[model samples]
Target: MQTLEGMIAPKFSLKNEVGEIISLDNFAGKKYVVLYFYPKDSTTSCTTEACDFRDSHEAFTALNAVILGVSADDEKAHTKFIKKYGLPFSLLIDDTHEVSEAYGVWRLKKMFGKEFMGIERSTFLIDPTGTVIKEWRKIKVGGHVEEALDTLKKL
Candidate 1:
């Protein structure tokens, strides 16, 4: 993946669960963004990571940050996952993987001894001015949200 710090985050306009347009620009000039890329929705690790973020959403908001999740899943799938998990934040559907490639999170992975292309769980914190303040790649779900929150506070 490319180093994105000190660089402007790639702007994208994608559909959310309700098919509403959600753009990287939407939160610009107003709030910090927690732009996260995950392999899929509702998977064990993804679920844990998302729930952790959801649980700590108030703290994130208090820090003037908004969480936005991204995956190759479509709007329908995102809706199902959000409903099933009660995810508080919007899940952006990146069906074409354009945004994923721009962020450099889509990569080759080996799981169960099988190689495949997938998203590497990663999070990027973009400041209000659109510059990336921090990024966490190949994230482990445990205590990760708190760490991200702490980073946001510092920013």
Candidate 2:
């Protein structure tokens, strides 16, 4: 697992579900960020994780943290997912996997004896200065958002 704590985060520019561009530079020197990369939208684990963050969105915002979700899913899928779950944060599109590759979350995987390429669920907590304060790779959904929130409290 790659731990980027105390390092400058890899910069990325991706369109959100609304087709508006969002980038690392947008948050730099403004607010801390909870940047999470999930494998897909509306799936079991992914939904759970997204909703967890949704449930705690106000808490994060209160701490001057911005929540952003990333996946290979396109704008249409993200739109549906956001509507279905009432996701309060932005979901960025990484259809080309560029941002995922930059974050090292793009990887190989095996399921039921089948090998495939996909994203490894991960999260990064970037401070206002674009420094990675904490990262969770191959994250388990349970309590993960709260943990991220707790980490932000320290910042």
lDDT of 2 by residue, 67-129 (tens): 999999999999999999999999999999999998899999899999999999999999999
Least well predicted 10-residue stretch by lDDT in candidate 2: 1-10
Superposition TM-score, candidate 2 onto the true structure: 0.98
lDDT score, candidate 1: 0.91
Give stretches of model 1 more than 4 Å off: none
Model 2 scores a C-alpha lDDT of: 0.94
The lDDT of each candidate is: 0.91, 0.94
TM for every model, in the order presented, reads 0.96, 0.98
What is the number of backbone collisions in each predicted candidate, taken in the order shown? 0, 0
Backbone clash pairs in model 1 (N, Cα, C under 3 Å; residues 3+ apart or in different chains), count? 0
